[model samples]
Target: NLRALFGYMWAHPGKKLLFMGGEFGQRREWAHESSLEWHALGMDQRHEGVSRWVADLNRVLREQPALHQKDFVNDGFRWVQRGDWEQSVVSFLRLGNEAAPPILVICNFTPVPRLNYRIGVPRGGYWRELLNSDAPMYGGSGLGNYGGCEATPMPYEDFSHSLSITVPPLAALFFKPE
Candidate 1:
């Protein structure tokens, strides 16, 4: 989804993205092609959730230094792996200045709860949950773990360190070291 790409653009502004039609607040998918029912706004959480996610992506891109900075190619970004593609769970790293704290980006696409999904952290330290698409305000299932970081060394040795977090389907999350 645009969330991941937009998040990357947040860290790497020079990159460009092209979202297909009906992506922004536009409801009524291809099936109900009736001029995008404007009333869809008040009908359900789907449009609202899309709008919020897009807004949040822009906000993070503009507000965070790791995202706002210009040197994203060589010094800013890297991809982190998730277990499944259909699940739509993906992650990436936003590198800061020398020794500066790196940020972690994660997105979960499954509708069901994903428990014990291992997301490797680059360095060993306390990482805090910065943004979660599963938050109650984001029109999600609200099934996620927050305010913690992976502390064990077993997975850290291989750079595939994982955090014990729950992922709601079609959600995104951002984490940063404290």
Candidate 2:
């Protein structure tokens, strides 16, 4: 099960989980060890949606200068939150040096919608939507609004303010400064 596998690996240090296709319980399985069933794509749109979501996620992990610029666990990696059932969301922050910009990454695992959600982001001016899992390109039903991003104020954590946004069901989002 992708859910069980993900939770297990998420807790184990230095362990990574890779699924063959969109095996995150979108309601299907890989067929007879051949090529990906392009037709089975019709059985469940969540498969295509979640697959694109994961692909975009990998692209972000690989290309984002702030995320890949240094060691993830060392420089700015921090688990800001978690939930009881472990069907939870997580957050990460990437702090900048003298010249670069700070970034925030948020992931959600809830099967239902999360609204008016707030998180602590580094103090800054406008932040841009680096990527969103709810976008139509990912096969999601596209319940998200604002194709781009709006301005986020600074000092948003204590020294920060409330960072407000909505998280569509089973989605992830990345943010970078504009």
- TM-score winner among the candidates? 1
- Pairing residues by index, what is the TM-score of model 2? 0.66
C-alpha lDDT of residue 82 in model 1 = 36
- For each of the candidates, give the backbone clash count: 4, 6
Scored by CA lDDT, what does every candidate get? 0.62, 0.56
lDDT (tens digit, per residue) of candidate 2 on 39-88: 55567665666565555555665566555455435664545444324547
Tens digits of per-residue lDDT for model 1, 8-106: 444443654544433455533544444555566578676666667667776766556675454545657777673458666767777765655677777
The stretch of ten residues in a row with the least summed lDDT in candidate 1 is: 4-13
Q: Which ten residues in a row have the lowest lDDT in candidate 2?
A: 4-13
